[model samples]
Target: MMRSRLTNAPARLFSTAVVSAPKPAATRPSSDKGGGGGSGRDTLGRRLLSLTYAKRSAVITINKWKEEGHTVRKYELNRIVKELRKFKRYKHALEICEWMKVQEDIVLQQGDYAVHLDLISKVRGMSSAEKFFEDLPDKNKNRHACTSLLHTYVQNNESSKAEALMQKMSECGFLINTLPYNTMLSFYISNGQLDKVPQLIQDLKMNTSPDIFTYNLILTACLPQRDVETAEKTLLEIQKAEIEPDWVTYSTLTSLYIKNSLPEKAAATVKEMEKRIARKNRPAYSSLIGLHAKLGNLDEISRIWEKMKSSFVKMSDTEYACMISSLLKHEKSEEAMNLYEEWKSVSTSGNPRIPNLFLADYIKRDQMEEAENFYNKMVESDIKPCYTTWEILTWGYLKQKKSDKVLECFKKALGSVKKWIPEGRITKEVFRNLEEEGDIEAAEQLLVTIGKAGHLSTEIYNSLLRTYASANKMPLIIAERMEKDKIEMNDETKKLIELTSKMCVSEVPTCIS
Candidate 1:
């Protein structure tokens, strides 16, 4: 069952007192009655019970009963309506409420009237709820009843309606409390209407002094907007007004500082939280870990992780993955591997990121077989290898002159454009190695492949052109191809082309020889 926020009223008010009203005894109906008695009541009673325990079945039953000639009383109808509203069955609730409205001589008590208004408010039919409230007899407009109507408007995001109700309550000599004001302020903040916050605070200062929740509400609103300067000023004002900052206040400040890229300040706030409250919350540890990682302070990250581990902080899978990757980045692969092994041992629930990090470590150590094994393991675990993983495997195959494997990996890399690919020195080395091994055909094919893929550079083009020229076959043809491809040639390249053309002409021996 979903708990209602409104149900936090004092226990004394909520307790049900047994009434002394007389119970009506069951009597056998006359045989001439048009509707059957025992069977009909039993079916209706079963449907009513289903409304509480089995909602869908209950809806089907209720509709079936209504379709038949059964007359559902206002009290019984209201019970179903209340259940529907609680379950967020707005359409059904509306249908039932409209049906109830048409029945004559059905006088609803104050509590039932409030429930109707609440349903109307929840459905965001404010005009309907307003009309209902206005039609109610003046004698029934008690403080609690008016407050319920006010909260209905608030829940519907209709602050102006709630304010009008508050004014009416004040006119009726009801002592207006901070609840409505806090609610309105929260609405304004949640909707990103920060300009309304100061005015609300001013109104509370002039009329009823603001409470801690009021200040906290303002701070919570300000945090996400990155309005830390205003939040800080508000904190000082809160302190001057004798309101002590709670855990929520500090947490908001920590998060705000982190958002503004002030990790040092965020860390300081976390320290303050640690000292001010002996017991810490989950967010505090999360903030610390995030801040330390952002600062590139792996030592501090390790310290915080150790503390969290000892204190039994429930680290999320993402946090665990980040820690492992950080360790691998710092070349503490042994420690990372140990942690990965431990995590695998304890965690029945699998995460792909851990294996991905392990695969990265294997690539870094030039352990291609081990890396391929991890990739296979990832596939077995139903974890799809990301594009970076494929890029790593591609480079590994290229280094080992595995042309078929290279082609396979290249396709995978191209599938995801955002993943990293080798550039500059490493790419030059791949081409150079291919050319030296007398695999000019494969090397030229790769050049065209990379050029089509937009990864080939002028240096790579020049290197391939020089190799072809040295072979003394189709130097002019290759040069013309480079020109047609719009690849820029430097001084050395121009001179090489001229010299190769002359060498090709001279190598054809004269007829006298």
Candidate 2:
């Protein structure tokens, strides 16, 4: 289960060597007799899945499959592409789509173009995807493509763009189905725009019938507002629509009941959740375990865990994480640690998130030794530390008053994350220690890194100035740096700059140089 780190390249710039001119058929692999279903031999899908590096191209695999004289069909290719997307192999998926487009013998359907467009939005950017959509022929700009672009807008939190796209979709009469509406509802609920759900539901009823997914999200919207009455009404609406509620429906209701302090009703809903749980649906099991824990039914958690073990031949990392998290919540650290060891033995994905959970708990409990040991274990096992890992370690070092280690971990934390704003309190504490230690160089590095992440605040700039002033050093280009960072100079900043100037002339020979 070694995973490839995902990287985004231009979707259109795939390998053309194999795609444009494949090898002779005589050089075809002798092992691939008939590359059809149910043969159980090595297939193209397996080869594509085996690629564990971002730089490797799926196009090479497809071209090699062609050169091997194997039968290739659009359906098979589409299936492989779908599976690749499911595994978060967006670059590989887009490569397959790109190869399909260049095939003169094959004609892509509307759905294929839609998937390609969606992948472009992911691998490239929204603007590229928008251009792609705009260039599509009128018929190809069907519900799927429009909805795909709309989904991109929602994902990017471009609310105005999303709304405009939805309006256009309605005008094009694409609202006859619930898919687009479901995407919108998901966007609204996730963005905390709960008040918009009812109106959207009204629009949904007017246009198309609400399905189980629709009502499930509607129920989810009710939970945060503690609106049990609305949740019940939504459930009734589901019944009227003759749509059976799924596991998520029951799970949301169970949570709502718990939130409203109707424990008996929550208990009843938990039973309903169990009835709806499909044998292979792991999320349902996780939800049920969480609900049971919320109801103070500790025994039920063990029973559910056992049931999950029996149901799945192998537990996924997510399932392990969920169970570990639930156990930790109930003060079951010993049991959680046991599960962590079990997961370590079997886990293939070097995901840092699971390890971060234990690191967080250990740091929270002030068990720095255990936290350090577990973190070292993760590093030994090739589980690269994510931002949360470093953040947890930083807090642990903060607790120990190890200023140097705290700043070191803080820098690593910032480096691990793509886009993050440092917490004001943590930043303040780190700078205070940095100023005391007179580590002007370290303070400057942190400031530059924070500025690169687009969070160089006035307070941060002031902190840096204070560090320089306290160290009897002059920040020679302080004015230029602040102007460039667009940090407005306050009275304190002016005073610090003036004071440091005097100190440089009077006391500090190094600063005068």
Candidate 3:
């Protein structure tokens, strides 16, 4: 793999034609039979055309010309497919290849074979791609194919199979290149097969002496398991090899220190990272915020935020949200509210209240009215609230024992998540809660409203049964409701209903019945 002389010169050579004369348009008349005229083909063509420029149309026209008995050279097709592949037009490219395979007297060169295998592998047909490799002529079995195949297996979580193939390649007198070896080592590290690192390192060192990437992989593998002593040893080995650690190395060390509850070490690593790198980066700041937040050092987090406010490494929405949430978590409600108002005033593009951090802060202080006002402001600004926000508001109102506000919040939440939830469960839970508070008429009205909406779940039926059992005078109404709703009670729910019925008859009913 590390021969003084490069053997596979063709792999580096520009085999693809850099400049080719464009073929004249096909002379044959257009026909719907072989072209994309059917529903499936039309759909494919439409999607292809939707991309920027009419690139998809070029692909379809090229394929159409070939289907209509017009001569199309391999170079022409390769050029179009290459462009399409760059745009992630995988499905379209695959369709073109499948069509080409059926034509007469067409030979796919090694480059075409490699590209086809890559496209297929991306579409999750690695087994089919492997079969394609097996069918390749001896001359085509080069480093590119082997490396790509190994990567495919690794991506698909078939590391054992990838290892077998690597061993087979070596047995056949094919030298395993650094590319494949590095990929395999990284795979081993990612999958927690750290125990195998010694053998891998020995093999590489004896053969090619493992590059910077190989050492970094070994170091990261040590970090995740909190083997800090081993990590330090690996860093020393890296320095002995005269290979300086890169951002990945520094970031991994910082993350490991933070994970092990050593914030001071993590912070020191960040300082080293800043000295090593030419410019500041986001990861260092993110790690700082995370470490400080973990240590409950809000003052340090705030200082970092201030330092990064106008830095090149800008704060992302989630990062800003995290800072506000941290302030709230530490009972700095006034500071959180002040920051929220400041962000709102400075945000020129959109509504700042869409994020839940402000709502969370208000709820932390048991200020339901303020939270509700913020929610209303969000609605008035035409910013669509996510399901999470609705869920938070619903639960928050329930905690405050504000039944009317809970009802309003539930209605708002239902508008967003109703289609995704079991209709019966929402209706049953709402009605059951209402009836438990002695609002039987309101519960029945809500039941009628949700029944008009859509299908309900069995949990909703159970809630209705519980509500009726609690009333002690609605047993017949419960049976009628279940029958009318066409709800098939599961065995467990049926047992509960039976047990509740017996209890309701023998004693004063409870709200949970």
Give the number of the best model, judged by TM-score. Answer: 2
Candidate 1 vs candidate 2: the TM-score winner is 2
- Sliding window of 10 residues with minimal summed lDDT for model 1: 14-23
Encode model 2's per-residue lDDT on 460-500: one tens digit a residue.
98898888877888777778878987889988888888888
Model 2: per-residue Cα lDDT at residue 281: 71
TM-score of candidate 1 to 2 decimals: 0.41
lDDT of 3 by residue, 1-513 (tens): 222232343422211122112322112222222233455454233333344442344456656655777666655455546656656767666656766666677777655666777778876487677776776665776666766777777787785667765654454434444677788888888888878777766666654666678767877887768888877788788889888887667767777887788878877876565455443456566556665666677778888788778675445555566677777777787887677666656554453433577776677678888988988887676567865676678667666655676666665666666474544444455665665774544444444445555655576566555565666534434555577778777886676577566643432233223
Worst 10 residues of 3 by lDDT: 12-21
- Estimate the overall C-alpha local distance difference test score of candidate 3: 0.62
Q: Which candidate is the best by lDDT?
A: 2
lDDT of 1: 0.63
* CA-lDDT, candidates in order: 0.63, 0.79, 0.62
What is the C-alpha local distance difference test score of candidate 2? 0.79
lDDT of 1 by residue, 210-318 (tens): 7878877877887768888888988898889888777667767777787888878887876665555433465566555654555567888798788777877456666
Which ranges of candidate 2 are over 4 A from the true structure?
1-36, 42-70, 102-105, 348-350, 369-384, 400-402, 417-425, 428-454, 463-481, 490-513
